[model samples]
Target chain A: METLTTPLLIRGRGVVSGRVEGEALVTTQTISGWGGINERDGSIIERRHELVGQSFAGKILVFPGAKGSSGWSAFFHMTRINGVAPAAMLFTRMTTKMALGAVVTRVPAMTDFDADVFTEIRTGDHVVVDADAGTVEVTRR
Target chain B: MHLTDTEKAMRDGAGGEAVAAAMDLLIRYGNALGAERLVETDNVAGAFNASTPSVRKIAENGMAEVFSRLNLDSDKTVEIPQMAARTCQLITGIDDQNWALQGADPQMVQMQRDSEAFVGQRGVNLMATCTPYQVGNVPTFGEHCAWMESSAVIYCNGALGGRTNVEGKESTGAAALTGRIPYWGYHLTENRYGNRHIRVEVPVRSMLDWGLLGYFTGEMVEENIPVLEGQMSGVDLVKLKHFGAAAASSGGVEMYHIPGHTPEARIADEAFGPNRAEDFHVYDAAARKKMYDTLQSAEDRKVDFIMLGCPHNSIEQVGRIAHLLDGKRLHPDVALWVHTPRAIRTVAERSGYVARIEAAGGKVMSDTCPAISRRLPEGVRVIATDSAKQAHYLPAIAKVQGWFGSLEACIEAGLTGTWKGDF
Candidate 1:
């Protein structure tokens, strides 16, 4: 591991309270909760999506918010059942669909960050999400 | 969130472990949504119990565990109790009555049957359809309901004047037990007013036009409630179903209003409320054509399958299909599937429409569609559908070539095994 200076910190509301550390996968585009994702393997399957064919499993998946169907939570629930769910989640804003997804997935989740998380976090950065404290700490790799 | 004494009692395990678990999940879900309290639900629609791999795993642990994991988001297994409100089960993974034609596995069909039996025993009505309103369980005007399917939710909010958010499976299941949903979103009257105004500039007749218009409008004004102003004189339930289904699929639109057509929107002014409409849009022929182009995934239309009646076909739609395929035989290489609610299918059977369609080598399926069934015949490459919702999702979900067109075009493709329409 490289020597790190002061790690960047951001704050948001803790929708689901927990602490997790994982590599971050950030996207500015909203992800569909239904057919947009592959529940069996945790891959973004929505055609032409920026993160198409990328797996968010065991990573800190960050996005603007959820788009598409109310069936979003059901597919996410299948991910949890398959043990392919992300370690944590961060959103710029929260919607009922995403909130219900986070709750059922039981992952450390936060939304409404004070800063633009999309700009602050990169795909391969090691990140720590402390939802109980409403904070995300990023360590650039 | 504030809860009534009875709700509190249920949370405290007074009503048993399952009710308490449900209450706990509801409170957590409400808290996540920043809801202040729970409101009573007069109507509820539960998620269809599918026999997916994950669902099968849940079933292995028994009904209690299934209820806990699927509904309560809990690991502790608990017995299910009677639903507190009028509850109906939405479409299942396979047509319970016609599994062989649907190409469903025997073991999976058995599992789904067992699951449905369990829920039915717990006092939930087994409607087994996406269009629950067609087969009873219609929520009247101003009623509070917890509905799971997106199309049904939009129909409930927009057409029937019933208030509901797009409820998830877990939330709807919990609401079935408690007859309560979190008081937020569409439940509030202030949020129901139209925020955008859309003027239809094209000839808006037929189910196909309505579906195309809805797809175009959803793409233009995503997630915003739109009040439409146009010549909507001949608009009926079939058109509304297609429109609302497409809108909900393409965008996160749970509610919309057509002035003088829908229950809530008597006039443009009434729908828009006191505030000035924030945006104005004109849906013209170009927009409709563009949406049609966007939904078609394949250039070569050597269609192998033709699917109709997504969101479940009404009696009139089935009649139309029966009329189109009256004496024509479907191409041997192509399979045609039509879906409708069971009750409507019964009517079609009585009217001899079902026999006419079956005589043409077509199967009328109930309780499931391609999206929910997630099963198409092996080696099938191209699929044609009249539903924009199915056309939008089938490509991504089923990983097949999707061709979207009118019901007549779909029928023509089924007969000739190739797309004959000019795009």
Candidate 2:
């Protein structure tokens, strides 16, 4: 486990209201919903993805938004059922696919962030997402 | 967000536990999408159940519970009620009829059947196809609908001129129960206008050419409405379907327009709104050829599987295949599968096209395709397809070498068990 100092605060609209704390996993590439993910494990399986083998389970996933197919929500729904879903999700932009994924996953999700989430958040940073207040507290560790 | 009195009543549990739960999910989904209000759609077009590994693991929970958790986004299990609008099941994981041919286990087949029966009993028209529009679920122009399946969404929005967003399984299910969707996205008049202009400089005649153009355009423009200009005369439903399906699969295009062909796009100016389009593109012969080359994975490999009817084959396409394979038998090693909607298959059966294909050692399947079902026969190394959507997706989903060509080329490959085309 990593410890933290004074945390940096960022705000956004809380799409799915809840609170969760986990390590941050940030990516600029939008994930494909159809065959982009491995459902058995929560790993990104798209051939050219940056985080090809990294698991999204129990992390605070940060991305621009979803891409590819409307099948995005169903794959994420599988992640939740397998107990391998992200603790929370943060998107710089929101699309119908990503929004529906957040809703169905029933996780603490926030989108339309005020800051550049890709730059401000790092892979190992401990982050707390308060979807109700539309804020995220990131503790660089 | 504003809800109508009826919507309010349903949200407040007036319609029953199921309707209330459905409303709650829709409200949240609408809010997340920044929808101001809910709009009543005349008919619910399609609803697909999630067929992921997790859903299969909990098969014993029954379809209602699976529907509640996966579709309704509710933790508490709820019984599914009769859909408020006409609803059809989209593609499932297993082929309902030809499970053994696809090498599915008996247990998996039984589970799929059980779920199908459960949903069927609840008044869902169990068409079990990706191309529901082919089988009497066609929404008229400007009709607001909630539809799943990427290819169908593009066809509904681009070719048929029906309004729909690229709806997810959950949202489609919710929309089926409530007969409504968030009044936003493609449902709005302003969002349908084209933002990008694609000038076609190449002669695109065949379905394969249209598919290549679509693949090139989709790769170039992601999530932007493209208005195509140039030679689009005599573009039929089959061409439009292949074009839109390829675009939707390669990119996230829910809708596209050909200036003269698409309903909303009579003139290029109207399609681009008041201002000139932001992005201008010219697709020439070189680009078309380049895209065709890119889709073909291997030229010399022996194709073990040849699949057609990606967006679900039209009856005309099925007839063409039967004509091509009239007296020729497929290679013993090659498994040739032709897919179409069940209704269209019924017509094919009556016309003896199904029998002809079967006599040629090929199977005319329905309700599923290899791309969605991900159930290719074991030990299959190379797969050939006429559909750009299938070629693009099968490589990633099924981990096979994909060769893409025209329907004629696919038929030839099926006959010889090898790909000799140089496209």
TM-score of chain A of each: 0.96, 0.95
lDDT of 2 by residue, B346-365 (tens): 99999999999999999998
DockQ, Cα level, model 2 = 0.73
Runs with alpha carbons beyond 4 Å of true place in candidate 2? A1-7, A139-141, B48-53, B298-300
Q: Per-prediction DockQ scores? A: 0.73, 0.73
Please report, as a residue range, the 10-residue window in candidate 1 chain A with the lowest summed lDDT: A91-100
List, residue by residue over B111-216, the lDDT tens digit for candidate 1.
8888888888888888889899888977899899988888898899998999998888899888888888998889999989999889998888977889988887
Candidate 1 ranges with C-alpha deviation above 4 Å: A1-5, B231-233
For model 2, name the residue pairs that clash: none
Colliding pairs, model 1: none
Q: Is the docking of candidate 1 incorrect, acceptable, medium or high quality?
A: medium
Q: Model 1, DockQ value?
A: 0.73
Question: Comparing only chain A of model 1 with the true chain A, what is the TM-score?
Answer: 0.96
TM-score of chain B of each: 0.98, 0.96
